[model samples]
Target: MSRRGQRLTHLELLERLVSFDTESSKPNLALMDVVCDYLEGWDVPFVRVPNAAGDKAAVFATIGPMVDGGIVLSGHTDVVPVAGQAWTTDPFALRIADGRAYGRGAVDMKGFCALALAAVPDALAADLRRPIHILLSYDEETTCLGVADTIARFGADLPRPGAVIVGEPTGMEVADAHKSIVTYHTTVHGHEAHSAKPMLGANAVMAAADLVSELNRIADAMIARGDASGRFDPPATTVHVGTIAGGTARNILPKVCTFHWEFRGLPDLDMGEIPALFAAKVAAVTRERLNRYGEFGRIETVEEVAVPGLAPEPGSEAERLALRLAGRNHTISVPYATEAGRFQEAGIPTVVCGPGSIDQAHQPDEYITLAALDSGAGFMRRLIGECGAP
Candidate 1:
């Protein structure tokens, strides 16, 4: 197809993709359908890796010959929610104006997916010895749960990639490093009693508040110590309490309290240390309360998310390929986590490079410029040329 034809196809496909409200919490099978149909129409061979519940799927497609050295273009199908966000345009409908496309996930991800899908015909038409693979997964906005499963299938049910490029919002730059994230969901248990006899009951909310304070102190200490490589903005592993809820009524002692917290740590940081400290604190509180309430007060914590971050490897195959495609020579690190780390951990050389700006992501009135879309399309063209069919 001509460049003009490709532009139309890209825009049309993006509009279609933006139509699906594939938020992280909802099932993304419908969005996968759009991708499957597009690949089918292009005669591209693809596989759908469905979750156990059959409510979600990850897609892996290949164009050109089934070769050993294949390049993987990866992106997530699920997006962040737009429930309370204020939007001038429909969050699910693509609106074009002033050389930009406005919609949720347009900049955060779907834009890259659309570009990769739109490039299929060109890739198919190119004469290439190596294959170009498209890997799209769900639930990236939540905990990268979808891509984690997809990686599990690689080299077993799926082909092992020589190099993987995660198309996160990078403004078309080669991103080499990012921070790892670990999340915890904590619950405090106590005995309920009348407000007049507070001494008879354990205070779950108070215990939870103390735990949160301890976490904050730990976070402060990390920041003060400062990690050796201060590439991250905060320059330290940070902990934060995201949400908390507990008390039922003002007059009664609450029986349960719960909160979710997260830690974004540098690659070199010992991940076990933070959790260990938290556990010790919980044990101390439990032991102290046991003497008074006799098992009425205790705490439990569950690891919610542990997304490993991408570490930059100087002159790695993934970085070199991304730089060539992006026409850049320098690489940078991001504070956000992506599936690139998971791929790298699996022994596949991986980099995060894609169009659009992270600044536009997860915000109200999110939009991607026409120039960014065109840039991504150009990158795809280069990738296709690099993977010419035999």
Candidate 2:
């Protein structure tokens, strides 16, 4: 166990963690091991939930005994890729300038995770009444897949948390709700023929273009629907296609085209209905063209992840606790998605409240101010006082 008088510094922990490349595509087992070791040093018991490949895993640790209800501190371990970003300094190395820590995951979380880890010593020293659970997940940047296993494990052998605080960057404001994210990859397969003989082959690129047009139409319709909450910026569900790829050369007709698209829905919106509507529209058009070609040229859509939007549960215990701890009288909604939605889906009431601003997240020279970290550390101290040591 760590000496009662000794506590890990947030800057020290952040520097060590940032040294590891836990990018979305790479395995985070190394970083997980380091975290597990730190927890073990603090005499905290934890469980590792491994992915199907067994290369990456989520770490769930509890400072108190197995109880009916505990408070979970959740953050994703993965950072977005810095491949194309223009950075003045090394993206992976922690650079401190003007009391700000700049790194890849500095703002879009890992700073919050480091704060949680650093607070373990203080939490352990307290006389707690309820357990404080730490949940660090992987693959949050790509798809919210790492938390799925942890969510499934709850209520079987795992303790169900009474409330979950997802440490997504919110500048310490209380975020009661956020938009749900649904990503889809659509593949269009057509026939290849000489470019001059265009009629001899169905155009996959054209089919994809048609689908993109329909997505835009959906976005326009959603805008007309407007938002009931009036908190969100756009106030309605929005659809966008991020990437599209098709064709090899100008002379030859392309046989396949693929496009990646996403939808961000308001809390009250029906997330599943959007994709279903698009799929139906694509099916109708594809079938008509396939009949002419006498072959089944295809269009298929696969969901990468579906993070449900959190509906504000009025007077809920989670909301009350979060509001009280954050010293806030009101809660707000965001336009981005976080792991809080997944936790809520698992029957754990959740809120998003953490340090730093979303504006700095995923941008070049990403940073978190020292003031933000200090404020977050204070919140953790108060949480320990309220919950007590296990």
Q: Alpha carbon lDDT of residue 116, candidate 1?
A: 92
Residue pairs with backbone atoms closer than 3 Å in model 2 (clashes): 127-388, 127-389, 128-388, 128-389
Clashes of each: 6, 4
| TM-score of every prediction relative to native | 0.93, 0.93
Which parts of model 1 have CA positions greater than 4 angstroms off? Answer: 1-8, 194-199, 248-252
* lDDT (Cα, tens digit) per residue for candidate 1, span 1-390: 223223337788889888999998888888888678777776778999998889999999988776666899999988898989999979999999999999988988999999998888788779667888999988787777787777787777777778999999899999999989999899999889987887788878888888999999999988997868767888888999999999899998888999999999887778798998998989887777632656678788999888887877888888998999899989988889998878888888999999999999999999999999999999999998888743
In lDDT terms, how accurate is model 1?
0.86
Candidate 2 lDDT: 0.86
- Candidate 1: lDDT of 115? 94
The root-mean-square deviation over C-alpha atoms between each candidate and the true structure, in angstroms, is: 2.8, 2.3
Residue 94 error for model 1, in Å? 1.3
Q: Tell me the lDDT of model 2 at 317.
A: 74
